[model samples]
Target: MRAGPLCLLLAVMSMATGAHAEESSPLSLSAGPQIIDLQQRLKESEHQRDELSKQLQNADADRESAQLSRLRQENQRLKLQLKEAQATAPQRLLTDQQQWFVTGGGVAMVALLCGIFASGWRRQRRQWLN
Candidate 1:
């Protein structure tokens, strides 16, 4: 009879201690709030990262557009320069041809004048000797 009563008392004491330990532990109470807080922080950081990525993409597009415009302007300027050079090439050829014609005419005139002077001097010398 005393053994049976001691066994019953020990079972009740163990049950009481287990219940007290469960109540004292913080894991049962704070776990939900801490998990929720961490999830919210992660979402906020992801949103911030997306916003920064979008801004960087916009900046890159703007820079590329500016460079494209500059390149187009340079191409147009080069085309105009090429056209001007082509136009001057024909004019330069015409000028060279005119110079050659003028030089040839002057040379022919000088040769004719020299022939006339030589013939007149020979006739005068023959008449004087006779």
Candidate 2:
């Protein structure tokens, strides 16, 4: 009884495999032209992609070069301005406002010192009974 079922299973498996093989052979015969066409399309698309990438790189390089030239010009102009500034006469160390502020501070310090010194106890002022 076991052998009978085993034989039936084997027979069904063989028929299924044979049917799959027959179907795949016809498909493979017709797929030759389709595969070649797909490969050619892939190559064309790859070529287009390469060209587009090169164009993008060239555009970037052009923009970068233009910016570099502008920066160089600006640097040169700034250098000239710096040289002109350095060639001019030396300026005073302090501006008018700063000088005035320093003078005021000195006067305040002198006033404070004088006040402390003048307020010292004198002989007459030391007599608390007077």
Candidate 3:
């Protein structure tokens, strides 16, 4: 009768240990799908990040190009404005040749007037003396 009770106790202890082992270990059937899903999600997120980065770079390049174009246009406009101002401005002072011509003409006129007055004065003096 003691042997029979001991055998029953051993069986009960073995069943309990087996149940504990099963509870402690992970179930492969559920874990496999979960791991695959997590990996797919990670890949998708990385792809999206790469795409966004590329788009940002492209946008920056476009913005810089647009700014460059606008600056070029403004520079061209300024150049045109400068040209127009110069064209519409007044003439500068007389050139060397023109100044020399005016000086020579004035000197000639003064010399001619002096000669005429001197000749007339000499004739009047001679007539008075006679």
Q: Identify the candidate with maximal TM-score.
A: 2
Rate residue 13 of model 2 by lDDT.
100
What does candidate 3's lDDT look like per residue over 18-95, in tens digits? 999989996679799999999999999999999999999999999999999999999999999999999999886888
| Model 2 agreement with the true structure over 1-130: per-residue lDDT tens digits | 5999999999999999999998887556778899999999999999999999999999999999999999999999999999999889587899999999999999999999898789874545355665
Weakest ten-residue segment in model 3 by summed lDDT? 121-130
lDDT of 3 at 65: 100
Per candidate, the number of residue pairs that clash is 0, 0, 0
Candidate 1 residue lDDT tens string, 1-130? 6999999999999999999999897766758999999999999999999999999999999999999999999999999999999888755544778999989999999999999997875655345555
46, model 2: CA deviation in Å?
0.5
Selected candidate, larger TM-score, 2 vs 3: 2
Q: After superposing candidate 2 on the true structure, give the runs of residues whose Cα lies further than 4 Å from its correct spot.
A: 1-26, 94-105, 112-130
> Scored by CA lDDT, what does every candidate get?
0.91, 0.92, 0.93
Give candidate 3's TM-score: 0.40
* Candidate 1 TM-score over all chains jointly: 0.47
Q: Where's the lowest-lDDT run of ten residues in candidate 2?
A: 121-130
State which candidate has the highest lDDT.
3
